[model samples]
Target: MFKTIKNDLPASIVVFFVALPLCLGIALASGAPLFSGLIAGIVGGIVVGAMSGSNIGVSGPAAGLAAIVLVAINSLGYQNFLVAVVLGGIIQLVFGALRLGIIGYFFPSSVIKGMLTGIGIIIILKQIPYFFGMDKNPQGDFAFLQVDGKNTITELLNAINALISGNISVGATVIALIAMAILILWSNVLSKKGKIFQLVQGPLVAVVVGIIFYVVTQGGSMNLESSHLVSVPVPDSFDSFKSQFNFPNFGALGNMEVWITGFTIALVASLETLLCVEATDKLDPHKNVTPTNRELFAQGTGNIVSGMIGGLPITQVIVRSSANIQSGGVSKMSAIIHGFFLLISVIVIPKLLNMIPLSVLAAVLFIVGFKLAKPSTFKSMFSLGWKQWVPFMVTILGIVFVDLLWGIFLGLVVGILIIMIKSYQNSHFLHKEGEDVDDGRIKMTLAEEVTFFNKGAILKELDNIPADSFLELDVTKTRYLDNDIIEILEDFGLKARERNVTVKLISERGIEENPKSYIEFFKREIKRKYPA
Candidate 1:
């Protein structure tokens, strides 16, 4: 882990910057104390990062859970909500133990790519307003319909209006533009020239410059307001800092509502974490595959620690994970160090951190977003043909127009439909041409796996067989034969006699001429394999 400290340290700083506003913003969106979000971020980074198998994946308070947390908090009260969070973590541990992490692999590759692209688009679109200092909504709100009663488009329009009316913050705009410029220059040119440039990342430089700009222009017309800056909870003293931590109400453990809320958090947080794990693995330059069960266990542990000390739910978030990967993080040390940075900074230089402009961070995210959803990605997916392209496009659009989970769900549905269509079309191979047709004989070979989904296609082809013909039903290579298909074959076999169609059933078990019962043949084969 220490082998890549040089890379991990610098990447950790970038992830810290990327995670800071999100921690606060998600807490605000969830209607919890802003400090709670920081607590989750700290625990997610430290505890989860230490335990997680993912080298580049980062965990923190998720925007996807903001709505659920919001409702859960209101219904259960803040203390009770903490209890739910703790319970949720326990549930996640159970999930890990059950080896349910395999669920992540079940998602199609196209849907996963779509998710990454969709999130990329979302990050870009959502940050535009903040980049211009039009902070009408929380920075962490990723939902299409926001808590502010406006959607993504409406917010963009409002930002445009603000820009046109000169209502936007000129300082923020200037800072963001400069920061973006610095990032591009550093990535494209400066970083390549020297080891020093690589050591000192562009995001770190941009943030420092943003802070300097804020300090230099203090009290001037170009000055950014408190809303345009990073807002870390500054503790006046040790006692106040300790007071910020809220303990979960153990008394709420027996409440049915608390259990339900806990289960909900566990389910949602696990799904989001698994999805992010898949996305993060794809994003990792090292091509490392994170152990999903370990990730679940780590997340569950993080949530428990976070909740016990007053924090929102935690999950492996794509935004922070992608930022870590993009920033050159090479190991889990980066994630762990970033958590420490969150811990130490809030304890030490929080006021100084508060001086950094949000727009500069927005600029940082802009680059991250573009990397994830480059135009080349869309073209590549399109070139893969419609089977891959349709689901990918649907996921991207769904994420942009709806929300994260819904978009992936839509993409998965489309992907499954495509799979079914392919399965229907490729259920069987008919050898009807040349000698087979010329001799009034036809050969129908079953696919490797014939399920109920292939019933229609097989039935159609069976019905098309002409009368007084020789029909050879071949299952020699079929690994799995669905009961429904077997029944269809049986019915066809019985009716073929009326059409004077001589039927021959072929399998590895040998051929049956005019078989009386298909079910009995399979039953006999099964008994042969496992005798009583």
Candidate 2:
């Protein structure tokens, strides 16, 4: 762990910047108290991060859960919703205890790729409003438009109006732009020159510059708008910490709606966490495989902590996890440290965090967003074969045009269809062609449980049989010859009449007759062969 610290500490700084805005954004979208996002972030990093066996995967309040949280809060009332959060954690714990983590392994590679690309697009889309200083609606919501009568485009238009009305903060804009530039330069340019600067981390440098720029702009004469700054509810002391904890109404726990909400949260959160873990492992240079069951256990524990402390539920997040890996994180310590940083910062330096301009965070997220939605990523997915590419493309479209889980589900469906199609296409049996040593005499066999897709292969192979001596079909073991294959055999049997070709039927499942019309004969013969 100590050896890991040297690597993870540098990575934590990068993760910290990435996580800060996300925590706030997801919380804002949830319609829960803004502090709840931070709490989830803190607990995710410290509690879950510390407990997690993952070296690079980071956990926090996921945007995927934002919609569920919003609906639950409104329908169940805030207090009752809290009970669901606790129960959801318990359910996740049960999942982990039952060793259900292997479920993550079942997701096809295509579906996972599509999921990653889709999520990247979502992050980019979600951050667009923030980049332009549009805050009329919540942050984490993925719907193009919110129920509050504003959407990504509308909010952009409103932000434009705000700008025209002199609402845009020049200081925030300048600092954000500069921070972005510094980050790009430091990461892409300076870091390549030496190990020291590379180890310093670009996000860390951008954050420092953003802070300095903020301080410098504070002394300037520019009339800056107030909405540009980060907002954190500052707590004065230890006594204030006690007040932050929230309690769930246990009496409401038995409500059917509450249980429904709990199930929703648990299902979505688990899926997102598992997907993120898979994707992050792919991104890791060391290729460390995170123990999924352990991760679920950690997430469950984190959520329980979050609910007890008035925080939102948490999940493994790709953005933070990627940042951790990219920034040189080697173990869970970095994640744990970042969580502690979140917890302590909110308590000890809430005012300082609040001073972090939203635009600056937006600049940071914009970079992260670009990393995710890069054209190279799309190209790479395309090269991985159609089985992978189709699902990958669908997932991207579904996420860009629809929602997260829906996109993944749609992609999975497509992937499964592709698999079934291939399975059907390849369903056939073969026998080596031989007459003793090198004779061209061919023998054909029918596959068990063959489908209609096997029609062409069976027909072509049977049609080419010579009008002479040796042709053998070994269907003795075939339990279920599809109607299609049977039809071919029946038609070939009729053709064999004038052709003088010898035919042999060896079967425990198929028809014994050499029938009349290929299609009609097979229909009758199949029934006669197996009268069940």
Candidate 3:
């Protein structure tokens, strides 16, 4: 997994860029100490990444949970909230131990696709302001509107208004355009010619250009303000760095409200983490399947560590994960490297990081969104038929209009409805090749696996079989038959007897004539076939 340093190294830098602003902004939005967010980012990247099964996923302070954190802080106090975070981590560990991670598998593929597309659109919408040098919303915000009461489209229009009103910073705009140009050139043109371009990525060059532009425009009319850039809390000395870390209050351990808050954090964090795992796996070019249970365990540990030392709860976040993938990350090492970057950069170059313009990072995320929500993706999904398309579109709309979890829930509901309708209509399990034989023979082929869902269909098919029909019930290809379905088939044997129908069970045991029940028939058939 660590073999692709050429790829992972540059990807780490891109994710670092994406993670920096988000960490501080989420911390700000959560009403927590600013340094706490960096702590979460570091723990999420190194601790969680090292333990996680995800190859491309990067964890950190999530924007989705910011509102919850803020409310908890306001109600319970910051120190008390930290105790809840620690308890939340413990709850997550319990969830992992109980193997509750299997819940992630229940979501339909269509819903998951919709989620990715919806998030992509949201990312594009959120970054539009920053792209035009507007700073009303934070960088990684996914909501249609913001805490400031402006919607995505309105904010987008505001960005355009700013552009029209001559509010654009020349330095930021120039660097942003150049950054995107260099990115396109590096990916399409330069990387193909030599190995040098592959080692050093476009985002790094973009950051360098942004820093230079900031220095050059410092005293000019076009100078960008501090608000238009990253803002990690600057520590003056070792004492300052030590002062940043805050421990959870033990006195809050006995509070009932703290337990409730911890449970809320655990539930929300787990859901977000699972969704991100699914989305990140889909985004991966290699299609590596992450161990969902292990991910929960890793995240729980991360939250415990982060909460213990003045940080917000950690979850696998899509924005950072997508940035890592778009930047050519091949393994978890990129995520781990990014954590170190967060740690070292804060200690060494907090001011330098603040110099890099929001527009430049916005350009990087814009590319990520483009890759996720390509028009071709929509076309391909639409081509898969309405059974798939309806749920996918609904999920996208719900996510765009509503929040993430609500949108996914709506899509899942639709997807399940489609499945039920299809299952009801597809009750004909017996595939009859020809009409009938001279002996009044009719063959019914069983599906590969018969489940309880097919019980109604099987009953209907059995109830309508013609009288005196010599039915050859084939289970040769069947693997596992559900108990409910077996009962249905067993009851059908009595019906077959009353109708004077000859039931020949054709299975791995060769054949049986007029068996008593499906269960007895299966037992005899197995005994004869295995013959141990």
- TM-score each candidate: 0.96, 0.82, 0.84
Question: Regarding TM-score, does 2 or 3 come out ahead?
Answer: 3
Full-model lDDT, candidate 2: 0.76
- Cα lDDT of model 3 by residue, 226-341, tens digit: 88777777888999889999999989889999999999999999988998898889889999999999999999999999999989999999889998988889999999999999
Winner by TM-score: 1
lDDT of 2 by residue, 462-514 (tens): 77666764566676556676766766677677777768666555455454433
How are the candidates ranked when ordered by TM-score, highest leading? 1, 3, 2
Model 2, residue 119: C-alpha shift (Å): 2.2
**lDDT, each prediction:** 0.90, 0.76, 0.85
Give the residue spans of candidate 1 off by over 4 A: 427-439, 515-532
What number of backbone clashes does candidate 3 have, counting pairs of residues 3 or more apart or in separate chains? 0
User: TM-score for model 1?
Assistant: 0.96
Deviating ranges (above 4 Å) for candidate 2: 136-138, 153-169, 219-223, 236-240, 427-532
Q: Is candidate 1 or candidate 3 better by TM-score?
A: 1
Could you tell which candidate, 2 or 3, scores higher by lDDT?
3
Q: How much does candidate 2 score in TM-score? A: 0.82
lDDT of 1 at 377: 94
lDDT of 3 at 497: 89
